[model samples]
Target: MPLGKGELTTTATSLHILELIVDHGWVTLRGLVEETGLAKSTVHKHLSTLRANDYIVKEGERYTLGLYFLTVGKRAVEFRESYQLVEQKVRELGSRTDAEVDFTVEENGRLILMFEAAGATNESTFGTGTEFFLHNTAAGKAILATYADSKRDEILDTQGLPATTNKTIQSREALHAELEQVRENGYALNDGECVEGYRTVSSVIKRPNGSALGAISAGGPAYRIDQSRLKNELADHVRSATAEVTESLVEAQSTL
Candidate 1:
């Protein structure tokens, strides 16, 4: 069987409501109408369908995401065995380094933090389920560096580099150059680019098919993860974790 476009596509309104619910945790019907500016009746009808399908759960007047998504998300991870591989690797790396570690992948033109492990440090880092842009974060840049040149260019052309901090790369040319460095150095460095006081070192984790599984990163406060520490001390740990994951994936693929 070949892939075919759906002849009857669902409206985006229901999905919009789902996004709103996910973003704000629990939301009321009135809040949905206020934010979406849809007629009260329309919002009510859509939400009723969502609730009926177990896509959302309502307690009193507020609705939150239902357990259905958890099942679906877990299946997604099961399908991508690379996720399990990356998760265990990041956990071990975080324990040894005592810095924040995360495994991030590109999804819908943004970075999705799929797994996170906290180091001994009191300072926190990016958490799971958070989304970030490619041009500003070390993990994103490491993933981008492994992409085809044309694909990378097209994505940046559509979503121009939006700065999150003063240190964020502002031009495609600059990002391209930075990725080159990432390739040469085997890891990407984020020096307060994603946030004011955070720095990260990341390396792309490759799957057996030569496509990127995601990126593994170790990040901490800038004072501790400064340039010297990022390059000389932490980069190797990130690269080692990514390399080991890639090897396992490649070996698994060879058997198949």
Candidate 2:
């Protein structure tokens, strides 16, 4: 049977409610109705269904996400066979560089933080599972640089280059030039592009077949990561870390 438009709309509405609950931490039925601009009756019906499924919990007038989300998130991470090795390398890179380290992957044309390790000097404001625009981040660029031109163009076409800061690349031609440099250097750099007063260096991790699996990054305040260090030391460290993970992934794949 063909699915109707009403069913699709209902599914989207339910997911939107869930996103609102995540953003606000806790929400009231009235709050959801107001935020969504939906009728109170419509909001309450969705809330009732979610509560019955244990996806949310109600305390008096407020509703909060339930432990079921944690269960699902954990399973999602464990399902990635190389996640354990990736975590270990990220932690090691953080310790060695004394900078915030992150492992990220592209999903649905956006970047998702899969693992992170905080250093003494820098603690990440964005946590695991946070989504970020791909064009403005070092990990995103590194992953993009490893993609075939056709694949890269498809993502760029779908997700238009939106600027987050004045330093962000807004033109496809300029971004393509930068990605070409990333390919030549085996790494990428973000200088106050995604966030002001911060900089990052990243390198891509490859699968056994030489395709990009993801990217790893090291980032910190601009004052601490000067141009010299960003280009040489941090860039080299990130490349080394990614190389280690790529080799480990290859070895693991061989065993399978």
Question: CA lDDT of each candidate?
Answer: 0.87, 0.89
Per-residue lDDT tens digits for candidate 1, residues 1-256, read 1223663223477888898999999999999999988899998988999999999999999999999998988888899877887899988988998888889999867999899988776445655688999999999999999999888987787777998999999988899899999999999999889999998999998877788889999978877667887887789999999999999988988898
How do the residues 46-107 of candidate 2 rate in per-residue lDDT, one tens digit apiece?
Answer: 99999999999999999999999999999998998788888999998888888888999998
Highest TM-score model number: 1
Candidate 2: RMSD over Cα atoms? 3.0
Instruction: Report the error of model 1 at residue 143, Å.
Output: 0.9
Clashing pairs in 2: none
lDDT of 2: 0.89
Candidate 2 has what TM-score?
Answer: 0.88
Among all windows of ten consecutive residues in candidate 2, which has the lowest summed lDDT?
Answer: 1-10
